[model samples]
Target: MKFIDSAGVEFNCPVTFTGTVTTTPSSPATASYMVKRWVSPTITQADLTGGQASQSVNLTGFPGGVVLAASYLQTTATSSSSNGGTTGATLSLGISGSTQAYLATGANVLGAAARLSNAAGTLLGTYRASDVPQVTITATGGSPDLAHLTLSCRAVVYYLEVTAES
Candidate 1:
């Protein structure tokens, strides 16, 4: 089912999902996962468990709302440049974004320094130019290959508004 308002008003319409990055190359870079929309401000990761990959979310508390679009990314880390593409190595991860602007891009997001925080709100990674936001994975020239780069991502959308009827 589609997530649309009968009154046709523009709402923030936010969604979220969590999944491990697939090791296979057949996996799409941006997998369209589904989410359960809630009227409340917060939705836990457990809310999306057992749901299908790229499935359209169903609204419960927010019954009237519709699920429109989804956005997320997956990345795999590669061996250091010194290695001739043999082993996988873990590297420091960073992400930058605007706490204020969800659509911020490039230096704009980077400048804001809005980054990913640990569950406690501690900064685990800082957003950098190399880390692709929503779709990209940053790498150093030819030294590191992002082949099978694995990372977790969460996407959120804000519902702009809602109407009683479509």
Candidate 2:
């Protein structure tokens, strides 16, 4: 069997078992069966624009029963000389209705880059079947002096569906 995901990634399920059996009867009936299944990883990305106090990305159509294996946020900032003597910015990622999963503060100087992930700090474990994962980005303690800043967020999800056989 072959499985395809929303990203068009293809995965082949190799049959692990094959067998034939016959039922006892005057005239015996025979049946053949094969079993094949696998788990595949899927990834989706959401881009966020900076300079705003708060930004949110809605992960609509996110499959249920799938695990939110991992997630991370990357950000880039370009500050002009005019930003001199201004405080740096602190960025954080969190669920729409939950506390921050990770936080990164940019350098006070111009042209600074920052990357943050929940991997070691506060891991966002597998999501619940009834949970809708909405990632939110919040920027605080930054001076409006910054020329431009941009943020991009990405999420990796894993899931597998089992086929029932009888």
Q: Output the number of the TM-score-best candidate.
A: 2
Q: What are the TM-scores, per candidate, against the unseen true structure?
A: 0.23, 0.40
TM-score of 2: 0.40
Model 2 stretches with alpha carbons more than 4 Å out: 1-52, 74-93, 99-115, 119-123, 142-148, 158-166
Every model: Cα RMSD to truth:
18.6, 12.2
lDDT of 1: 0.26
Write model 2 residue lDDT over 1-166, tens digit each, in one string: 8855559977798544356432233222334222222222221122545344455555555445433335444443442233333334433433456535422222332344443453322433443454444445444344542224333333333333222333
**Cα lDDT for residue 45, model 2?**
21
The 10-residue segment with the lowest total lDDT in model 1: 70-79
What lDDT score goes with residue 43 in model 2? 16
> Per-residue CA lDDT of candidate 1, range 66-116, in tens?
322222111112113223431232212212332212222122111122233
Give the RMSD in angstroms, all C-alphas superposed, for model 2: 12.2
In candidate 2, which residue pairs clash?
A: none
